[model samples]
Target: MWVLVFFDLPTETAKERKIYALFRKNILKDGFNMFQFSIYMRHCASRENAEVHIKRVKKILPEKGHVGIMCITDKQFGMMEIFHGHKTVSANAPIQQLEMF
Candidate 1:
C-alpha cells in the first residue's frame, strides 16, 4: 500500500508559516517523500502501517488548514498516470524497505 498526504496550510502570518514548515519537517522526518508541493507520499507494507503514519499526521496537523490522506494498494498506485505539460513522468519506482531480522 501507499500513503499519500496532501495539505494546504495558511502561510501568510509568521506563526502560520512556522506551523507550515513544522508540518513539512515532521512528515519528512517521519519518512514521507515530497511527491509535489504540499503533497507527500510513502510506501507501506499494509493498511496497518499506513494507519501509523495517518495517526502521526493527525497529531501534528495545524488548526487552520486542510489535510487529506489516503491509502491505496500497490496495484492501484501503479495504475496512476502522471504528466507534466506534454510529457509523462514514470510513477513505478519500486518500494525499498530495510527489514531487520
Candidate 2:
C-alpha cells in the first residue's frame, strides 16, 4: 500500500511560511517522499503500517490550511499513468523493505 499526503498551507506571512516549511520537513522526516510540490507519498507494507504513518502526520498538522491523507494499494498505484507534457513517463519503482521476524 501507499500512503499519500496532500497539503495546502498558508504562506502569506513569514510565520505562515515557517509553519509550511516545518510541516513539509516533518513529513519528510517521517519517510514520505515528495511526489509533487504539495504531495508526499510513502510505500507501506500493509494497511496497519499505513495507518501508523497517517496518525503521525495527524499529530503534526498545522493549525491553518488544509491537509488530506489517502491510501492506495500497490496494484492501484501501479495503474497510474504519468506523463511529462506529451511524453509518457514510467512511475518510480516502490522501495523494497526487509521484514525482520
Candidate 3:
C-alpha cells in the first residue's frame, strides 16, 4: 500500500523541530520515508502494517496541529492521475451589452 501524509503546524520557533522529531522517530521505527517536508509517502507490504504505522504517527502529532492522511494500494496509485482543465468561462463580465440590434 501507498500512503500520503500531510501536516499543518502552528507558528512557533520550535514547531518544525517538534514535528521533525516525531516524524523521525516514527519513520525510523516503522520504516517510512520523507517524501517532502510536512508530507510523507510510504509503502507497506500489508494493510495491517500500514495501519500500525499511521496509528503510531497519529499518536505523536501535536494536538494543536492538523494532520491528514491518504492511503491507496500500489495498483490504485499507478492508475491515479491529476487533471488540470482550463476554465471555459471567464471570471469577469462582458464589458459591452447594448451594441447588437
> RMSD of candidate 2 to the true fold?
0.8
Give the alpha-carbon lDDT of every model. 0.91, 0.95, 0.67
Query: Could you give candidate 3's per-residue lDDT for residues 2-73 as a string of tens digits?
Result: 767787766576876676676666765675566557766677667886788788777776767688988887
Q: Model 3: residues >4 Å from true position, as ranges?
A: 80-101
**Model with the higher lDDT, candidate 1 or 2:** 2
Q: Listing every candidate in turn, what is its Cα RMSD in Å to the true structure after a full C-alpha superposition?
A: 1.5, 0.8, 17.5
lDDT of 1 by residue, 1-101 (tens): 99999999999989999999999999999999998999999999878889998999999989999999988888888888999988998896748777898
The C-alpha TM-scores of every prediction are 0.91, 0.96, 0.62
Query: Per-residue lDDT of 1-101 in model 2, one digit per residue for the tens?
Result: 99999999999999999999999999999999999999999999989999999999999999999999999999999999998899999987878989889
Q: What clash count does candidate 1 reach?
A: 0
User: Which candidate ranks first by lDDT, i.e. highest?
Assistant: 2
Alpha carbon lDDT at 82, candidate 3: 38
